[model samples]
Target: MADDPTKKGPADRTRVSTSEAHELRYWSEKFGVSHDELKRAVAAVGNSAEKVEAYFRDRSRDARR
Candidate 1:
């Protein structure tokens, strides 16, 4: 089955669904970033949530320098 539109979060927690507004909101909130930032991260890396989170961690470290 497809994702439930009424769901608050993504059906698959391991991936980011850029095509879904709720997915963007959920991921952005979880990562404490804006929607655009999340989208950029997804694009730069891939849809893998683990990779996206790792990308943010790396970015955070880079920002500290």
Candidate 2:
């Protein structure tokens, strides 16, 4: 475990935590999404990073159509 998990990144990189502002910022930027969009992704997919990423990928693929 990191002394400061927020700064070092969470031990569980597979999940996204909206409770931490830093984490919200980190994920949103990482996924090229707005904070609200990231929150919506988490809400829709239960905070699993892989699912959120897939959600975006699917959305992008749909949008390309």
Candidate 3:
């Protein structure tokens, strides 16, 4: 099995049919990073599940502001 967390299997990848820009914004908000930053982070971290969860937790904490 492949070890990359970001590499979704064929069944896991779904088409959302949304605007590309909107989708990017949604991911940035969901991941708690700027659009450009998120792209870089995903590339650097390979979208590990654990990393994503940690990002969410950190973002949640910051959201209290």
Give the winner by lDDT. Answer: 1
User: If ranked by lDDT, best first, what sequence of candidates would result?
Assistant: 1, 2, 3
What are the models' TM-scores? 0.89, 0.86, 0.41
Global CA lDDT of candidate 2, please?
0.85
Clashing residue pairs for model 1:
none
CA lDDT of every candidate: 0.90, 0.85, 0.52
Question: What global local distance difference test value does model 3 have?
Answer: 0.52
Question: Which of candidates 1 and 2 reaches a greater TM-score?
Answer: 1
- Give candidate 1 regions above 4 Å deviation: 1-3
The numbered model that scores best in TM-score is: 1
Candidate 1 lDDT by residue in tens digits, 1-65: 27677888888899988887777788999999999999999999999999999999999999999
Better of 2 and 3 by TM-score: 2
Give the clashing pairs for model 2.
Answer: none
For lDDT, candidate 1 versus 3, the one ahead is 1
